[model samples]
Target: MLYLTINETNALLRTAHTDAFHLEVSDDHSAVADETEPMRRVLAGLPPFEPDAYPDSWREWDELVGEVTAHGVTMRRVRVVSEPLTDYVRFLQGLTDRNVRLGEDIRWLPRHLVDQADYTTDEWWLIDNARVAFTIFGTDGDFVGAALTEDPAIVDRCTGIRDALWRKATPHADYAPGG
Candidate 1:
């Protein structure tokens, strides 16, 4: 595992091929998530999700997914969890065409883990397993701060959290907040 400050993480995300994104939103009003949209697009290499429709930017995201798949990368797994359903739903519903994702392959973990996350402020930890990229964000609406690293410990912990989430999450579609 490598240790990268926020800036380094952003850089890696730019070139990361296959990633396992573990995005956590501690705040009900997620400002950090908004700021990282560009990073998301770069890592995903897809257009934004269009809110007007269900699979608004399905093909574009699919193209990106296809690219990863071609690299023998399975679906780029993003384990995002926010506060109350109202908050989480608002966050999910606000996604654009490229960002919008159906529960098809996503896993919804128990919300209790939100309290278990190691952080003092609202943050996001995006782990690119293939590239071994780990990125973190600390922010309030317009003011955002971040850290990025490649430490094996960071990688392992992120992987561990993902594993826990996978084991705890209900199948994506059936996910109901607070359960």
Candidate 2:
């Protein structure tokens, strides 16, 4: 496994284009907790992040999606979640609308309905069906790091899984978010 820090991972993604940015989100990693919620900002009557650099995910993500989609790359994401949703998953659902508006096609699949769809214990990103960055998460579903690989067979397998799951997963609009 090739280890890469989160920044290294983002740096690589920034250079990506001409490929589909497909993510298989298998767990709720509480990543959204790190970002300041819009409602909180409204409650505090505060302004948006200034400069909106790396740590400012709201702006960084907006820029990233704008850049990637402008290059004709399709970004699709699928989440496999269990019933009796965790607080993190609920938070994620609240955040999906922003991602959808940013041009990502998001979907959700409940655990009972997973059936035979392929899934990794952790999350992964399939870029262009050519390369993959398998993100490692801790036992508590915290962000760990990622491994980058380009083996054709590995890419092919992940591509097959992504295609299959995406076809069956519920689109963001149709899926109900559990509490």
What is the lDDT for 139 in model 2? 72
- The sequence of per-residue lDDT tens digits that candidate 2 reaches over residues 11-46 is 667666766555655444545444535434433544
lDDT, candidates in the order shown: 0.46, 0.70
TM-score for every candidate vs. truth? Answer: 0.51, 0.77
The 10 consecutive residues of candidate 2 with the worst lDDT sum are: 42-51
Q: Model 2: residues >4 Å from true position, as ranges?
A: 24-27, 31-55, 138-144, 177-179
Q: Tell me the lDDT of model 2 at 172.
A: 95
- Superposed by TM-score, candidate 1 places the C-alpha of residue 154 at a distance from the truth, in angstroms, of 1.9
- Candidate 1: deviation at residue 101, Å? 5.6
In model 1, where do residues sit more than 4 Å from their true spots? 1-11, 14-19, 27-29, 32-70, 75-84, 93-104, 113-146
lDDT of 2: 0.70
